[model samples]
Target: MMLIDGKKVSTDLKNELKTRVEELKAKAGCVPGLTVIIVGEDPASQVYVRNKAKSCKETGMNSTVIELPAETSQKELLGKIEALNQDPDVHGILVQQPLPSHIEEYAVTMAIDPSKDVDGFHPENVGQMVLGNLDKCFISCTPFGILELLRRYDIETRGKHCVVVGRSNIVGKPMANLMLQKLRETNCTVTVCHSATQNMPELTRQADILIAAIGRANFITREMVKPGAVVIDVGINRIEDPSRKSGFRLAGDVDFDNVAKMTSAITPVPGGVGPMTIAMLLKNTLQSFARSHNL
Candidate 1:
């Protein structure tokens, strides 16, 4: 089975974005800018925010990270978001997730301006997706990256049976929505399986393209995969491993070792979908800049 190299695809996308940023700077006297706000010091959230900031700089764009304390009040955080919303220099605004227990996510998600909501979590952006107005709103990064991978690989999605195993707003739902769109890069028959799905394997075995985003380690086994089907594993679960210096290893939703034997192509855990998410975020930021500047 051939491996779907997400790292390479993301690198290519970043290079293109870098050039675009240069063109914007030369023509408009400014480059795209992204601002990330992290409420708590969750280790994973911190790492994600740091990487986003670094990527912004690498792509020749302006980057800013606002680190708030765990006890920061909701009003305080919302105030910060409003300030970023009005900042002309900031083309994209993202709030790193998993806030402290006292902070309600719904409020924070709604606070960001839809035009600058690069994370695509705002209802306004989601409404555009529901209406199939793909050009008018930002798509959540993971699903967008999956589509890019399929398009780059010349995967014929038209009329294909694409199964998405997850229902989270972040990945599964958007993925299913995108695959079912009447577009050349999408236009596939989609089936979504969730925790309540009965006879899940029976449904999954019928897929031409299978996407795993259940956030569980090795949840999709070989028995659930169809032979010659293309598998895209979007789950990244950390498992303890004594052999590793970090005392743990990362794994995907599918059992890559066994599932790879059944699928014609598949993506690995760490290198597969992770890099693409960041790449797409940069792309969205660039798009926002282009739209704002009429470029």
Candidate 2:
């Protein structure tokens, strides 16, 4: 079985992006800029934001982090988004997810200007994606990362059967749409499954490519995977493990140990889809900059 080394892939992509940014800078007199807004003190979000900021610095892009109190009002947040939207220097705007319950997540996402919606959560960006527009400013990060991984490995998806086991807007839905686009390399016959999907294993076993984004720990076992299938695990669940130094262990939706034996290729937890998400975010940020400048 081939291990899908997302860490190496992400590193390679980042270096490529850095080189591209250098070329763009020499020609355009500026690099891309990404602005991230964090509403609360969620540890995971904080870590992600920090990593993104570091990536921006390494790539010669400008990045800013806007931190707000947990009790920040909805209107206050919207006001901040509006400011970022009007900032010509800011190519991409992203509001970290799982905003405090009192603050409406959709409202904040909608507040972002479509052109600056690097997270691809805005209705306009999502609509453009549905229409298979390559010129769209952004697509959701995780799904975009999955596609990148497949492409970098020269895995042809055209005419293949792909099963996506999730219905989330952030990953599953967009992933299926992307895979089914009428593109030469990505014209897969895609099936999307969710909580209510019947005979889930039976459906999964038929896939030439299976993506698990269900956010459940070790949910997809060897029985669910077809031999020679390419498995992309997008789930990152933190399970308690006192034996570990951090008192927790990261796992994906697929039971990696067992499923890897059954599949021809598979992504491992922690190092799989996780790193690619950030890489894609950087990619989207650069794309947004290019679009904003009509480059």
Candidate 3:
């Protein structure tokens, strides 16, 4: 089975973006800038934000990170977003998730300008994506990265049965919509299975391409996959592993060891969809930059 190496693919895409950044810099006399507002001291979010800034610098883009206390008020956060929205140098604005319990996530989503909504959670961008107007939308990074992986690996999806095993807005819903669109690289017959889905395995076994995004450890077993199917594992869960130095291991929704034997190709946990998410964030920021300058 062919392993879908997200690390290698992400590196290649970043290198290409680096060159594009140089071209844009030479023409525009400035580089694109991304501003990320992070609230609280969530360890995971901190790591992700650091990686994003590093990637931005690698691509010759400017990165700004605003660290806020856990007790920061919602009004203060929204005001910060508004200020960034008016900042011409900040091409993209992203506020990290899981704010303090008092803060409403939806309000934060609505605060960012649609043009600068690199995370693609704004209602305007979502509307454009739902209408198949991808040119005007910044799709959620994970779903966008999955499509890029399929394209880069030359996987055929036209009219093929694709099963998405989740319903989360970040990955599943957008992925299904992307596959349903009449695009050359997508255009798959999609079936989405969630907690409400009946006979899940029976439905999943019929797919030619399977997307596993359920937030569970090894939820998709060998029996659920069709032979020769292409599997994209989007789940990342930490499971107890006494054998490991960290006493835990990262696993995807699919049982990689058993499921890989059934699929023609599959993505491994930690090195699969994870890396591509950051790469696509960089891409979306770059796109915002290009549009700002009408490039």
Candidate 4:
């Protein structure tokens, strides 16, 4: 069995983006700028935003973080988004997700201008993606990253049976759409399964490529996966574990130890899809800048 090393792939992608950004800078006299908004002090959200900012700096792009207090009103947050949208210097806008329970997530997503919505959660961008006009909108980071990994490894999806477990806008829905697109490597027959799906195991077992994005840990076991299939784990769940120093451990939806033995290729939790998500965010930011400037 071969392990899909996402860390290595993300590094290569970042290097390629860095070189391209340098060329754009030399020729166009500008580098991309990404603005991230973080509301409240969620530890996990803070780490994610910090990683995004660090990536932007590494790629020679401008990074801005707008920190808001936990008690900040929704109106205030929307105002901040509006300011960033009008700021010509900001090429991409990403609002860190899972905002405090009181805040409406969809409202914040809609507040971001479509052109600067690098997170690709805006209605306009999502519509463009559903229409297969990627040139007109930024695709969601995680789904785009999945396609990148498949392309880098030369995994052929054409006419293959691809099963994606989850229906969230961020990962599963777009992933299914991308795989079924009329493209050479992505012309797969796609099936999307959610919590309401009956006989879920039977559906998953028929897959030539299985993508698990359900937010539950160890949800996909060896029995659910077909032998010699390629598995991509998109779920990142934190479980309490007293044995660990942090009193918790990170795990994917798949039971990796057993599933790894059955699958021809699999992505490990910490080193897999996680890194690629951030890399793709940087890529989208660069693309947004280029589009805004007509470069």
lDDT winner: 3
Better of 2 and 4 by lDDT: 4
- Candidate 3, residue 76: how far the Cα is off, in Å: 0.3
Span of ten consecutive residues with least summed lDDT in model 3: 181-190
TM for every model, in the order presented, reads 0.99, 0.98, 0.99, 0.98
Q: Put down candidate 2 lDDT per residue, 1-295, tens digits, no spaces.
A: 8888999999999999999999888878888999999998999999989999998898889999999999999999999989988988999899998899999878898899988888888888888888998676488989888888998888878899999999999998999999999876579999999999999999999999999999999999989989999999999999999999999999999999888987888899989989999899999998888877777
lDDT, residue 8, model 1: 96
Colliding pairs, model 3: none
Q: What is the lDDT of residue 122 in candidate 2?
A: 85
Candidate 3 lDDT over residue span 152-192, tens digit each: 99999999999999998888999999999988779988999
Query: What order do candidates take by lDDT, descending?
Result: 3, 1, 4, 2
| Alpha-carbon lDDT, every model | 0.93, 0.90, 0.94, 0.92
Model 4 regions more than 4 Å off? none
Q: What does candidate 3 score in Cα RMSD to the true structure?
A: 0.8
lDDT of 1 by residue, 1-295 (tens): 8898999999999999999899888988999999998987899899888899888888999999989999999999999999999999999999898989999999999999999999988999988997899899999999999989988988888999999999999999988999999988789999999999999999999999999999999999989988999999999999999999999999999999988987888999889988999999999999999999999
RMSD of each: 0.7, 1.0, 0.8, 1.0
Clashing pairs in 4: none
Error of 3 at 157 (Å): 0.4
Regarding lDDT, does 1 or 3 come out ahead?
3
- Clashing pairs counted in every model: 0, 0, 0, 0
Looking at model 2, residue 251 earns an lDDT score of 94
